[model samples]
Target: CKCPLGFEGINCTDNIDDCSNHTCQFGVCIDKINGYTCKCHSGFIGKFCEITSQLKSSLLQNNRTEILSKTCTPEICSNNGICYEDSLNRVQCRCSPGFIGDRCLMLKSVHANRNDSYMKLSKPKIFPHLNITMIFSTIQNNGILIYFGHMGHIVAELFMGRIRVSHDIGNSPGSVVFSYHTVNDGKIHELQLISIGQNFSLIVDRSYTRFINNRGIRTYMNTSEMDG
Candidate 1:
């Protein structure tokens, strides 16, 4: 006798399969002579494996079913980052406070000793317009504040209880001095230097002094560096 669709027994009398259309849904199918069985995959259970486990189904539905494969692996994100896609759909490496950068690779600050300590900074491009201001309290009457350009062509120095800024363009050299009697009295003082249209001005405690050099070559604060 010829066997019917799901049955392959000699007499075709055994109902071995409980699967649908001889196939399993979210499960595996097995033959039982004249029938088949549905061996449900994880998180599913039923005669045909059609029912979802209550707790696990809710978890998957709430967490987006499609992105289950896009999760961050434990080895992927550094610095203990709980990886998740941001609203912009871009991956973000969330960093804690006092930490920054995409991978949290930078620290905000480092403790340093009082003497022989320095911090490094990236070099920046030069701009034409410039204004410099300094507020300081010093007991020394002779020291350098700011020096720049080749051979210290431009400088702001403290000499003999006075703040002096000297600039030289071609052969025309000029200096502006702000002599405050109490400058070295260990009191805070403000000094500002402003450059515009080949001219510079010095202001000490709101007292303004304008210096006009020989009107020939236009000059701006050109410097390879500036340091104390």
Candidate 2:
């Protein structure tokens, strides 16, 4: 008995699958006569076709090795955003939907500006209470991490650095400031605020601050606008 064209056993019982264990990386491995062929995938080429064509093209354009320098690391852009360097060599981040900020770390907002930013939400069926939670990291000593507006009025605001909750109740403004560890050390910090009935509390890390609303005996009596 003789072995067939694509077989190599004593009775042509074995079929040669050259793609076994062959690392194609970015291509497919095709079996051939006496050997195998690498079918390079799109944007890749070489003998094994494992090299990225984009990198190869850059190398051929000029001898300057700087063309191959990658400014954006794999982890540089958060939330599946593309990281690329502009013509001025500044790193830029393109964030996806529901994400913002320089590194795509911020949740998308309705209105944004250097002075102030806000997110407007549809009025809920009930407005008896408000609760908020946020996680952020910044070195700025002041900023509004969260704000809630109801009936064309500023109802609540959570400030940065020192956790503060300012609110308006029946044409009177009240605030509760909590002394806690600041998040200006380039680390993420969690802040939570809950308002129910005639009471509210602010929590930063392990520190807690609570305020009670006294209808007859007012602890704080001031009418002012809260800053964000």
Candidate 3:
């Protein structure tokens, strides 16, 4: 019989701990589960702590002036988040998806998923991919969905009802990918984009449009976006 996550045995009496295996490849193993999780000895993501993603050391954000005061109040954290001590001993608020920044206060305009991990684009450190999702509907057919620029730019836009995502790594020429479907329909639609390196994918309502370039994304996608 198939056993539930973390459980195995004829009667499911045994608990399977892959923490020592390739599961926690980049992070430490923590049997505990917590929200605002990304806590340590490493991380435990999602409801069951089933997903073992990369989580490393992080400092307490300066936004929490009161954190060092040795106090944790509900007011400091939003969305019913819980205050927990991260690996660095810095106090952080752990909660549901879509929120980033100190205290998980910045609710992204785009709807996001739980798999969307906490990120600080301000840092030079890059990751394999950046994921974000949102459900929206509008009569307008053109606008920028998201934009990140510094030496160059990574952007996604709704052009004539179709989704287009483009990026340039370092000082190189940019590459782009477009979605297979248009979402100008009256009904609310979901859109998600993952752009990195020389490849990217545009996902609309579960349908996907992907692209690959000789560039082969190598470093962390750059951080920060333009207002207009």
Q: Rank the candidates by TM-score, best first.
A: 3, 1, 2
By lDDT rank, best first, the candidates go 2, 3, 1
**Which whole-number lDDT from 0 to 100 does residue 82 have in model 3?**
74
lDDT over C-alpha atoms for residue 91 of model 3: 70
Q: Per-residue CA lDDT of candidate 2, range 19-78, in tens?
A: 554545456778765567778878767767645465465556756444333588877666
Q: Across residues 30-144, which tens digit of lDDT does each residue of candidate 1 receive?
A: 7675567878888666666655454244445655344233545664344454566878676556754333444443333322222233334343222444577766666877777
Off by over 4 Å in 1: 1-127, 169-176, 180-182, 223-228
- The 10-residue segment of model 3 with minimum total lDDT is 32-41
Model 2: CA > 4 A from native: 1-117, 124-126, 149-160, 206-209, 214-228
What is the clash count for each candidate, in the order shown? 4, 0, 7
State in Å the error of residue 181, model 2: 3.0
lDDT of 3 by residue, 1-228 (tens): 877767778998776654333232223455532212222233434333333222111233333354343456767665556787777776777854544556554444332222332223443322555666666775558876676666556777878988787767654677777777777776667777665554566677766557645263345454543232
Candidates in order: C-alpha RMSD to true structure: 28.6, 21.4, 19.7
lDDT of each: 0.55, 0.56, 0.55
Error of 2 at 79 (Å): 9.0
Query: Residue 78 error for model 2, in Å?
Result: 11
